[model samples]
Target: MRLAYVHILPLEYYPPATNAIRIFASMDDVDAAVWTSANRKSLPEFNCDGVRIHRLPFVNPGTSAFLRFYQCLKWHWDCAIALRKFKPDAILYIEPHSAIAAWIYYRLLGGKARLFIHHHEYYAPHDYDRPGMKLVKLGQKAEQSELFPRAEWISQTNESRSGFLAKDNPEIAAEKFQIWPNYPPLSWNRKSTQPAINGPVRLLYLGSASFHDTYIRELVEWVARFPDKATLTISGFNVDPAVWEWLEKENFPNVQTFPQGWQYDELPERLHNYDVGLILYRGNTLNFVYNAPNKLFEYWAAGLEVWYPQEMKQITHLQEATTQAPLRRLDFNELPTEGPFPRPAALREFRSDYSCENAIAPLLRAFDL
Candidate 1:
């Protein structure tokens, strides 16, 4: 089976899209290709373990609804032409924009490829009520009303979000939807041995750090208060300018920031040194409240214990289900003052359980491959 993966974002920058394509390509019966865009930061061509990647030209539709609408139409046209040429048996479309493009190809362009939609982040109707989102809102509405019913399979990050999606689109059958939690590949597991805690616990908050609706300030301040007990490292892309400015001026002795964050492929090697991986989402939106981010599994794969907000009920449910790794819930109101937050000792035995290889089983079963 030839499968084409469609995503508007640069494939190399999005771990989930890359992971999914890799998984599909690794299958004996499937030949996978990625149709994506080249952002300013991304190379026109990328190596996804030898899978074919075709990138459309990038257009910076900066904050203009007209420009964004034009770009979207152009992308749709380009994607449809590519799909027609590729003649894929099936297509996996990530995010609403990609799904809308796939819908256009399948419906209007006489493309016969089976459609699958993956929602990396849940978005409500009102979520797209901003200035440059009129086109996006229309596309999302079309996806809910038309695409959902036609899709052979649809996936969300977790069961909670899947339930919410089903509720929103009652016309689509429940069985059509599946949960594909953001999990790292089993190959990425590099479980480090737990050493005896001698000094301060190494706490790392890796990934997108934002000033709004996150615990960045609180975490930094708390770590600053007790430099002897803990050290904080903030690293990742899309870090808010406010965060950078504050960190630059404050210059907390125990806190470090790596503005040039490590790439997704380097995570297994890069993350093992930390004792704890902090998830700092403050649950300001419904999407955030039930987020099953890839970083959680990435941290576990690297043998680090995870600390997350109590407000993320989906993560809390995952924590309850697993004894493979330790997942601690943080109470922002009362920060813990303690020493020796150690890495899990059972990582050697249980780290394999938190892999994309295992997570994608249900997806494979659904495909009946």
Candidate 2:
């Protein structure tokens, strides 16, 4: 079966979870391709284990989405062009704008192929959708203005987002919207060798260090409380010099800074040695509240505890890993200071289910290829 997929954040196969459904959906005997805007080495085209990926590439260089609205519009246009060229048997539209691209493909193909939308982040019931329902409705019109109906099947990652999509559009078929859990990768069996508990335990914060989510000062202040007792390691993106200066001023004496990246596969392997991981997002907006950050799963992959706020669902979902330890106010007791219940079986289950096999089963069934 010839299948095409599209997403907003480009192709990221290395971090495992970034390409979870991609790996599962295109697993065995399914000839598939991908189309995305985020440019990462010929991804959507990588040959891994036994999968063949072909990404329809479109680059928007020197372009800035000074505004969020225009950014989505530019993304939809690029995806539409990419779909028109690849013409696969079906399209799994993973992002809002990409769904519009797939819809245009269906219209041009005379509905010969199907279109499916994957929803990883959706607005909860009590709250307005991400950016609010007002913005969601606004986005709907913007995409419909380009493609006729936009999406055929909306596969929600969880129930919260699904309800919002079907709440007003009950006329939409029920089968088109199904539940697909976001199970992290199956590397859980490989637990990090526990570091010396008696010595200072190593705690880490990985991924983007931008000021948007975590202000450097807040983390420094939190670490200030643990100068001699705990050590915090920093990685992801080059550490800004200003952040380094601030770290010195905060007097986090034991703090260590390392190059902020690893060969995508190297992280889980490296994580095995750390005691616990830290997630410090300041906002409680839809971006933070509805997020199932891949890092949480990666933390699980390493069998390390995660220090996070109560607002984080993934932290709450995984009983073994996530801790309610507040970073700024801080409490080390909330962290998993001891023990390793190696969960390889959990990872095997997660890999099998989240492996492109289980994740994309619905899309494959929908197309009947």
Candidate 3:
């Protein structure tokens, strides 16, 4: 099987896309290729871990709504042209926009390719009510009316999000919807034998940071309140400018920031040092309320305890199901005020139950690979 994975963003920046491409390419019966775009001046075509990668020319839609709309159309055209040339047996659309492009390729251009869709975020119709999102809203409408019914498989990160998607599109068959959580590859799993902490607990937040509608500010303040008992590290590629400005002005002694975050490959070694991993989404939207991000499994793979918001129904269900990692729920209103923070004993050993290899088993069975 020749499989093409289409995503509108840089593949290296999105671990989920990279993970899927790698897994598909590694299969004995499948030949995988990635069709993606980057804003850089030059990105040569390359092969990564058995998968061929093709980088399409991309225009950075800097803050301008017109440019953003133009860029979206350009990407759809590029993707359709590339898919027509590749003529893959199956195409995995990384998001709705990519699926829209695939729909154009097969429906309008008379291409023959089985369509599969994987959504990283759940967007309700109301989510695109902004003026700049007219194109996106139309694309989503097409996805529901055309792509969803036509797709052989459609997946979300968790059951809760999948339920939301199904609820929104009742015309689609139930068996077409599947769950593919964001789990790290088994190679990234680490066995940590660190003894119980005799010093301040090392807490880490290792993803995008945004103050608006997120608990980032509250988390930082809470960590700062117990500087003598805990130390916090904020690191990611998408850390907001305001976060850095506030950090510089406040100058919290125990807090550390890594604006230039570590590469995805370095996570196993780098994350093993942290005692706890934080998920700080405030659940402001239904999409967020059912959040089950890759960080949760990555934390478990690295032998770190997972801490997430109480309102994240997906994470709460996962915590209840898994005994391999210590998962805790945080209530921002009732935070501990004193020291001697409770830490689990030696970190649990790496468990196969939490690996990407395990998570993708159902997907493989569904694909009949």
TM-scores for all predictions: 0.92, 0.70, 0.93
Show how many residue pairs clash in every candidate, following the order shown: 0, 8, 0
Off by over 4 Å in 2: 13-18, 21-26, 38-85, 108-111, 123-139, 142-152, 168-171, 210-212, 238-245, 248-251, 258-260, 317-369
Better of 1 and 3 by lDDT: 3
For residues 1-369, write the lDDT of model 3, one tens digit per residue: 888888876776678777777788778898888878763423233347887787776666564767867777888887888889888988888776566678789778887788888888998868878666676677787788777877899999888889889988888999999988888998877667677687899999998878875688888888888878899998887778898899889999989998877778779888878888899888889888888888888888878887888878878887778755578888865676674275767456545356677887887776668
What TM-score does model 2 achieve against the real structure?
Answer: 0.70
Worst 10 residues of 2 by lDDT: 344-353
Point out the higher-scoring one by lDDT: 1 or 2: 1
Q: Candidate 2: global Cα-lDDT?
A: 0.54
The alpha-carbon deviation from the true structure for residue 196 of candidate 1, after best TM-score superposition, in angstroms, is: 2.1
**Tell me, what's the RMSD of every candidate?**
2.3, 6.4, 2.4
Error of 3 at 265 (Å): 0.5
Rate residue 174 of model 3 by lDDT: 93
For each candidate, the alpha-carbon lDDT, in order, equals: 0.79, 0.54, 0.80
Position 92, candidate 2: lDDT: 69
lDDT of 1 by residue, 52-115 (tens): 8888865575646667677777887788888988999888888886765776787778988777
How many backbone clashes can be found in candidate 2? 8
